[model samples]
Target chain A: MTPKISRFFAEHRPATPCLVVDLDVVESRYQALHHNLPSARIYYAIKANPAPQILRRLTELGSSFDAASIEEIRMCLAAGATPDRISYGNTVKKVSAIREAHELGIDLFVFDSMEELAKLAEHAPGARVFCRLTVENEGADWPLSRKFGTTTTHARELMLRAATMGLRPYGLSFHVGSQQTSVTAYETAIARASALYRDLQDEGLDLQMLNLGGGFPARYREDVPTIGQFCTAISQALTEHFHNDLPDILVEPGRYMVGEAGVVSSEVVLVSRRGGAPTDPRWVYLDIGRFGGLAETEGEAIRYTFRTPHDESDPDHSPCVLAGPSCDGVDIMYEKARIPLPNSLRDGDRVDILATGAYVSTYCSTGFNGFPPLAEHYI
Target chain B: MTPKISRFFAEHRPATPCLVVDLDVVESRYQALHHNLPSARIYYAIKANPAPQILRRLTELGSSFDAASIEEIRMCLAAGATPDRISYGNTVKKVSAIREAHELGIDLFVFDSMEELAKLAEHAPGARVFCRLTVENEGADWPLSRKFGTTTTHARELMLRAATMGLRPYGLSFHVGSQQTSVTAYETAIARASALYRDLQDEGLDLQMLNLGGGFPARYREDVPTIGQFCTAISQALTEHFHNDLPDILVEPGRYMVGEAGVVSSEVVLVSRRGGAPTDPRWVYLDIGRFGGLAETEGEAIRYTFRTPHDESDPDHSPCVLAGPSCDGVDIMYEKARIPLPNSLRDGDRVDILATGAYVSTYCSTGFNGFPPLAEHYI
Candidate 1:
């Protein structure tokens, strides 16, 4: 078991389905980011796990923020982050939100369409704005397809509109997608943004900043290159693509900073034999389910590694389908995960779901089907 | 616009992505159920929409509760529901949840497996127990699948064990599935349960009740047989199958009780044309999405009817893909819903999603990516 989980249970017995976060691991991850990408400013995305303790810890680390909403901005400010260090990263936003952010002295913002640009102009004039460029975004576990960014031509027009609307066109931004696995995805995205930056300069709009959006992968069940490897690839790409001059760089790391730092401890409610056939998947029900904060399972598309009380060397284990404690059938966590679950596992035996620090609690439903919200206990 | 929606916006200008529930409509739905199935008892599943105002109104309407957790039992009691009127409906539960429910005076409980029956015997001995029978649930908008219920043989063994363990073998329950469209699905399931009920009686353990679990369809985007049709089919099936005698009838209607009684009022965040070709779906971003209380959309598997400010017959509409304001690509509500969107529809225009009272708020994620939780405004 991870030391944090042991520490959590040792300090005090908690109910089933509790999130245990290791603050020491978080600090180490933050240090790794700065150590590798010395040229890039770090902005911690609060959406992954917005616990106040996490925010306070990051603020103490001198981390900036890539806030997606006004609530997140307020959270960052409350955690001691300066207004200058916060960026309104969401392209799609309300006019009132724009006004409030500007009122709070948040100048840096992002937009992708002229519709949003017009709203910004009417709501908060003369604010620093960045246009998001659409990327191919291949090899990402969670590909950010049509939901964000815009076509290159549309982005150029949006930046031009930003300048005309009296808004300072400060930079260009692009995301390679969340949990992006390939190093080449960033290289290609950087090259595209570099070209756009030079082209905007030709239009007399020389953007001085480049916000390489968050896609930094976390070490979940699978293996990902170290943060240092990702940073080195990005650094080489910047030197090769921007050749003459490098713009001030900013990176938003949400999952990568917290995913490995937390573990979810849940109890098994039932181990029922369903489907009857030996080839059929056995159903293993838990107190916490998809709505109970393990939603990233997303129809079991993201296979998280599972660990039971059995020793790692134990050869006896069972493969089973995992489900949550809700009336809705969609509350399934894993359709068929080949985890080393003990055959002797019964009701009340705790199962450790590793690397669930990010996206679990933040995406939790509020007491669906009489199941209470997933409890979070930070150390 | 729906009358409740207009009245809601008229009375109070709430924030975007809000759920407006009409208690008067809920009362009407309750009366309809009573008029249609006088022999059957109604248990409103609190998981559908557990707004306190809703629970209180239902309590005032003399609606019994099918609680899924101890928290739900507390909510029902707080709303003035007697212990005898409540049933612990969820099959999968923790030991503590069972203990607390028993402590709170709830006795009617449901189970589908020996494991859960054992837990109930240990935690809440001598309590009334109902075994859920697995059914071939077809024509359901949300199929229960393998998450609940058990094989006929397994259920029989469970009931016999319940009697052996000093628990009252009260009934046999089967869910034809939530939002089940076909009346025949219930008829088939009821016939199967009736046969098993007779078999259990042969074993000297006569089941006293048959819970035709929640499957009653609601009028969502499509048409369903009226409550009268469903009731007649069920009533006829019970008489025809049971012949000599029938147990007390119980019906748990979740979505049917409140789906049409509520409307979701959300604002259009962005209306942008992407993908280029006529075949490419236009993207319509909304402040509300799957995470924003409309999770029943189920990755566009469940389409909700929408209304805009445009006249119903302006011949000016577009088929657009709907997405939430979050940066995640999976925040899409619909891939292609042919909403009657005005050609002039822009940011800040209101769009009313109809028949959203059920499953919406219950499955909503809390403040994902800084987007606030869906606010409920009851009329």
Candidate 2:
């Protein structure tokens, strides 16, 4: 936890299952990215955590936004961001949403298919649109599938078609994946996007931007490469691929900007062995669970580091199956990859899940099984 | 879709990504269960879909409730259910929640471990409690792990401990699993609970209730056994085990009570081939996705049947990868088990996902990726 969040928890002793975010941590992370990758314009992906306080802070820092929906675009606008500073980044767009965004003076959009391109041409006419290129998500913890992006071959055709349909074929974009660990993933994606960029240039279309969609890493159970390392790798790739005629770089980072700034403080609800021998792992249930915002633990993929009050004083620790307080069968967070918690942890004890700032609050079900959404506090 | 829901859609033409539930279907389903399991007291599991309309109707029908949390218990009370008609059924619960529910006059609680039993004894002293026995979840679509229940050997000890701590060991309960398909699953659970009941009786603790916890299936893509078949199997098992010494049976039915009563109407946001061969499946993006309430599609466990506007007119239908309209990678609903959509399907077309009445609304993220929660409408 950040020092600000740690201090907030100590003073307020806020209710359980609440997220405490340090605003200073968010600003520092943004500045680190800005200093490291000076050439790239950072478009904060607001879908990661669209807290009003976080948005207002980023807006004051002059950060652009990459919105996943019309509501997100409005959130950015509501936070004092101008319409020109937002990009509708999701490739799939509803016709009404497209029209609403267009009428709201949002010109930039994204698409990977002819159908979406056609909708853009009809609804948001002359909007600057980017074609998403299909790329590998090898090293990402939350690897994306072929649910998005198109092959470079198909993207070429789509860009040409967008121009013919009176839409501005502005750029090409690719995401290695979310929580991407390997910098090589970005290198590979840049090369693919650059090849497509050159191919489109030869076709008499000058793409203005190369959108490096968010794949930035956040520290969880393991350490990841620093922001400087990612920026250096990205900077070198752009120099090698585009040479003297480098296109304007646009990086949409969601997780990296705010992930480590927050900690989820939860109360231990129940600790049970369920009739097992002492060798068996005990099940530790917390106030928060999959429905309460830890949806990333669907397959035990994002293993989070945990802290309890007895961490230092209690010498004995044991592996336990971590779970949420919901009655749903699938509310389990970590079962296969058992979490080692202090043996003294029991009901009413405080447990804090670290680095849960970005996704936890938003991913929470409004009130699944009658449990309210995860509460959020930005200090 | 039920005629009422179909007609409601025709008349209202409500916004996309909304769930419409027909209350009459819920009543009929309740009546079906009531008729089939005459000896068993039906406790409508409020966690399935705790809509006020559904709860009030069930309350009017003299149905008891199995609440997962204090909020759910409050909802049941607001719907006119007396505290005596409610049972706090979640095995894992916070101490504060136990105190709150006990103060609200909720006397019945469930537990599977010693730790949970102690909390109940201290917070809800003299209350009636039941021990949950861990049973195999064979032939269940959404099979539960050993997350909520204990072994019979452990439960026997816990019940004995409850009695010693001045709490009534009211009953024994077991869940085969959610969306359970096999009739034999209930039969097996009943047999296990009966064996425990007899063992506990021999030890001088008379258990009054046998909770046949919910595992009832909703018809999705595949047809499950009729409710009659399940009730018959349960009835036969109870008779075989208890003979002339029948106990009060409590059946908690969640999904089976409301799954068929609702339909999720969604707009086709984008339909893309993603530059694939003509033979390759198309990607169908809906206004709603995993975060929008189709969370049961996580591992494609609950395969929902779909109805498009072109289903009847279009002769050519092809397999498609179905996804939600969020930018999240995991939002893709069906990829491996491709859903068949009309070849004519495109943007702006309406698709109705069937049998979503139960888990969809409750499981929806508050607003993942800036999309609002799935709107609910009860007719």
Candidate 3:
């Protein structure tokens, strides 16, 4: 019987230091998301592995893009994504990037400050803007209230300023923060945004888009909510707040759209005794380190499933620390996890670290310590 | 008067994140090493930064190189380092890389196993070999007893195996570990390797080199020993062991050669209130992160000094959490460090993180969550 890992290895042997994207999984995920969130438009955040092949696959699945930089915006455009569908969503805007956005015919951009608003006005006088609101959420795993957005009180004034400058404030957006586990956080942000929307309407302002900035958690583990449940809650909140007659909703799901679609495959250079303890042992160090797939969870003990190239029925399992080739002890991915490996695992045993689709390939410290950038292979 | 950061910043203040190298400090460091260890050959480990300009400067100063991979070996060669002056020091070798080293006329390589020796023989028939001995110093901060190097018994056998295969067993090498605080760790490793060298000589093998691998600590903080003292102890030990008739001593000094020569200059994007007493709170998130200069020391709270762009004299000090632009909370460089910043630090304040030369640029993760690579500038 063919092993699951052997199927992947059969298609491609471990290309030394490479990031492999599972196209089948990506396509299935895209279909699932589209099926689940029919009312909402999905925008793939280009920051997660901006390989052209990945971008092209995403675009083919009828996904728009969330671009934070000019380079990202260009990547989306080059990948045949329509400029009108791309949103230049970075709160901070360089004058040159703003001008480039305008030249590229990107209609939507986000602004957080009056200074930024003025700069946007000078660079792109008729750009459509989204006023980012700082929502206070005590329950967020990662609170973003301290950076990138203005308070609700300040956001109202910023929106008014944008109106005075003849900039079209088409939408109101707020990010509950990255990796938000609480579904209630999204409900609260939407309620606050709805109040602001109602207030703006009462004050004789017309708004047509309510972009609840995406933090729909991807299932890094099996416990996270499915996209269907998340979208259902969001749809219910919109119905309760705006009577189902509200503006178009935009959801920018970065990891959710792509996280599971990517896998980082590495060869086991040597399997040796790390000599920590029998219970909580040391590791079987890989060629990749924090410079690769492990960049997603830098300081945390992230769990990654490791399997050998030729293993069928319940491959031999052991808890081993995963370390990189760099001399630094801090260069670890999964400190301790039950990894399934062949009993015959030796030097040159190929291992696949699963479900690293988002934020792994693109964000790693590529040029650090002269370690080469992860080679990318798209299936 | 011109601001200190003005010398590094480009026109229009583009947010091109950069690592800056100070030539004056690097030259002084080189001079200090030359002055103290006049008889010892310094092989600057190219794995530190491997920036072409830095490599060229070190080569010009008569420093040899220690390369870990074919890529690193190629980089040193491209930077004008002769193969004779380069050591293929990494213990594990790919067949192709071994063949490349042999074809390039590079003779010095390290091996820890007989299997590796067999490959080395098949690939590079007449290559000079070094048996990397494992010195198990349990009390040392960096206990590298598990990886790469062979045990004393294994080292002897590997030496014998190489000699049987007609390979020149010319030397013994051992790395105490990175950032080793115990100066005596070197004495221990040297003693063990000396025993191995004598054993090989007793067996009719004439050893010509003692490659004492780098663990020499840089003065990261005032508590760490100065390089002067480190060199003195190692120099004294070599003289004692070989009675001033030592067969060419080679030291691989990576961080010590370049750690103090680099500085990371960044703009403060936001100053947030987090992770300290509410009454006397402390935190400042910079645009740079653990993904940049702090990549080498991920979890540990690194001791670093910071200075304002304009004011260098009044080092307004406070301990604050330094974080990167990534939404991940663990994207912290220093969770706490007394940074000399003005009390009025806000968004757009410029900061220079000093002594980032050695491992900063090389091991950085780029574009995690779409953040761009730190722009690099060499003086």
Q: Per-residue lDDT of A272-374 in model 1, one digit per residue for the tens?
A: 6753345555678988888988888886756677777764656667777788888888888776554557777778888888888999997888879867778
Lowest-sum lDDT 10-residue window in model 1 chain B:
B273-282
Please give, as one word, the docking class of candidate 3. Answer: acceptable
- The 10 consecutive residues of candidate 3 chain B with the worst lDDT sum are B272-281
DockQ of 1: 0.66
TM-score of 1: 0.96
Taking all chains together, the TM-score of candidate 3 against the true structure is: 0.81
Docking quality category of candidate 1 according to DockQ thresholds: medium
| Candidate structures ordered by lDDT, highest first | 2, 1, 3
TM-score of chain B of 3: 0.89
Q: List-wise, what DockQ does each model earn?
A: 0.66, 0.84, 0.26
Residues A175-216 of candidate 2: C-alpha lDDT, one tens digit per residue? 999999999988989998999899999999968999999989
Winner on DockQ (2 vs 3): 2
lDDT of 2 at A229: 95
Residue lDDT tens for model 3, B1-379:
0133346555435454677776656667777877887877888887777888888888788788888778888888898889998988876666777899899989988877665687788889988998787775543343445555667776787788888897999899888876677778887777778777877888988788888887665555546777778778887777777775677788888777777777777777656442212433445667777765566545453455676754655456455656676545466666544454565676567777766777778666666655677777767
Q: Model 2, A219: alpha-carbon shift in Å?
A: 1.2
Off by over 4 Å in 1: A1-5, A275-280, A312-314, B1-5, B274-281, B312-314
